[model samples]
Target chain A: MTAPRSTTTNEPTDPYVDLPVPDQRKQQSWRAQGPIVAMVALGGAVGASARYGASMVWPVAAGSFPWTTLWVNAVGCAVIGVFMVLITEVWAAHRLVRPFFGTGVLGGFTTFSTYALDIQKLVAGGHSRAGLAYLAATLCAALAAVWLAATVTRRLVAWRQR
Target chain B: MNWLLVICGAVVGAPMRYLTDRAVQKRHDTVFPWGTFTVNVVGCLILGLLSGAVATGAASSHVQLLLGTGLCGALTTYSTFSYETLRLAEDGARFFAAANVVASVVAGLGAAFVGVSCAEALWA
Candidate 1:
């Protein structure tokens, strides 16, 4: 495994980072969640598979930028933004449908852990410039993608009603 | 095949993430997105360990796909993190929003670095 580079941060650590909070939602019986669990699992499998396929199609060399992961995350983030508006505002679909698509499919498709690892690899591999560039670019692009997609989608929806 | 492993691993991982997030979110009323933060850090740690194992030949590529690619990848999410942070900023929680991004990124990378170091020590 690659050794960690000398990246330093002096940010004060929060003690409540892992603190357990009190449960506020009503407890649902496990029996009522059988179908919902199934939908998420099925959707997750498909989403992960698609991600794996993308990586395969556009394989990355070691210590290089991970374009496939970036593309998947950015695209997934945008889709989720647009999807939330549509499901909440436009469509009155089945309850499980949102879980399957939004929570399951899109959630599974976009990954945060891999993104972290990629950044770590890039930084540790003596490519700090590339790593920093990636970090900023991804954060900006993802947020922009979501905001743009949602704004345009909302406009389109409003226009349709006019 | 790797495909099968990915499917099976994700089948379990995704639901586990949902359940864990739900369970964690239920306990806290904070808008800090503790659920996503927890999962992302934990997943990074696991993936780092897995990467170490693969490097030391303690684990194979197939195992990496099953656990790292499928489980860890599906378990943690960027979309929710991004969306939550964006929402927090839009809602005038700039400090919390900035804290979320910095904390998640810094803590995640630190956890992963530690994990990799631990795994390397074990295999050494």
Candidate 2:
């Protein structure tokens, strides 16, 4: 039971191996990707809006741990884990779904830039302990959340199939 | 007004990130996630600049909301970075996993600090 589960081997070990090349087959421009762009854009807007709303509800004060951001990132990581597991192992979701939810919404919802700024401010403001604690907690919790969600989701999917 | 701007900024930032990550990853064939790292660093720089402007009264609150809270917020992602790092460690590449975490945090902070400094120099 502790052995590593090799569920999906479809993804390249080096994910960057399949770079998009110029389409010699057609004279189509970058407009061909317009639909995906729109999907991502819409999803991003919604996600960011939700995050802003969350911040408004539980605003982060100066020199304090940003609970909102931490929670958002952790939740986003877990959701992404479950999402990827379902998409890869259980259901073949539409291509647009991945871009909209995985890339756009979840990506927008969980921010690295603000986290960095928060850390800088905390350290500069003499809240180094809180900053360090926040950093460690965010990293550990997020990784754990994703690992747990993905593992459980995968197992559930397998159980259902059996 | 702030809400609208936030949405607009995210509309542009999110897609820009998606495209940039795709383009960058396509060019490099490595297990290390240089694409996400690049975006996060760039976002921190922009956020730092925005913070500086806000602090110096050079920009309005609305501008900060739009650019910093909205654009930068959507552009950089902690989830993907964390997930990727975990995956690396799980795959037995413990060295790369540690490198990812350290490099991202250190470089992101450095970039934000630089951004603020640049903004102060220009504004003040």
Candidate 3:
């Protein structure tokens, strides 16, 4: 079972995890998810509000390099790295915590739409250098931030466990 | 107030994302994270159209605040995308991890451009 699980024709990315079929999923009523949904919504409110507030405090004019959004996404990605590490190894986070803080807050805070559009606008406005830079920089920064944060967190957690 | 509009939009967008993710995940057992990919691309598309509409005077600033800043912002997520990519790489799925990054960026950017062009055609 273990051999087939990891070495099947499917790549490592295709997990062997079982998922609920449509019929089984239909059995899960929406009303049953009220609390989880509420937590996600509440966390989203706080996260989105924070992001909007950032824009207000350091407003970037249109057609400019959207440094604010880039930083926001990078910071959010870093936080998620720490958060996920803690939840997985250090703390057995509450079930709601993952959905609320992880999915809702972080997800709300770091935006892909804005990133894409920033590139589009910059390129369209003839600031192709800034556009290309923003595109690559955001991706690199966000990914590096997450990877670094996670690795550091894991090391810290291991030391603490020791 | 501005905060209230954003909060209102976020409350809807966030839950919509959670629900959509759950729904999408339930149908697939892959660890490739198609759920996040779908939401990110869809969000970019909507935001693209909304931006174009605003530029063409078809959409108001308030709408942009509600839908673009709050809804679309909450709908798409760079944090989750990067995190998932890291996970894939760490788990020895380097190819999948790279594919996820490229596909998400390309598709999301494509969607944004398409939405804008569509809006410009209709409005401009």
- For candidate 2, write residues A53-148 as lDDT tens digits: 999999987888899999999998899888877866678667678778877898889899998888888887999999889888988888898889
The regions of model 3 sitting more than 4 angstroms off are A1-28
Ranking of all predicted structures according to TM-score, beginning with the best and ending with the worst? 3, 2, 1
- Backbone clash count, each prediction separately: 3, 0, 0
> Which candidate do you rate higher for TM-score, 2 or 3?
3
What does the lDDT read for residue A114 in candidate 1?
86
Q: Rank the candidates by DockQ, best first.
A: 3, 2, 1
Residue lDDT tens for model 1, A1-162? 111221211110111122223334434445446677788888888889989999999999988878888899999889977887787679976868766877678778888888888887887789988888887778787888877887889999999999
Instruction: Kindly list the interface RMSD, in angstroms, of each predicted candidate in the order they appear.
Output: 8.9, 4.9, 4.2
Question: What DockQ does each listed candidate score?
Answer: 0.44, 0.53, 0.60
Give per-residue CA lDDT, model 2, range B50-101, as digits (tens).
9988988999999988998889999998877877786678777677778888
Order of models, best lDDT first:
3, 2, 1
Candidates' TM-scores?
0.88, 0.90, 0.91
Answer with 1 or 2, whichever has the higher TM-score: 2
Candidate 3 lDDT, A88-158, residue by residue in tens: 77886666787789878998898999999999999889999999999999999999999999999999888
**lDDT tens string, model 3, B10-105?**
999988887787777566555567878889999999999998999899999999999999999998889989998998889887877888999999
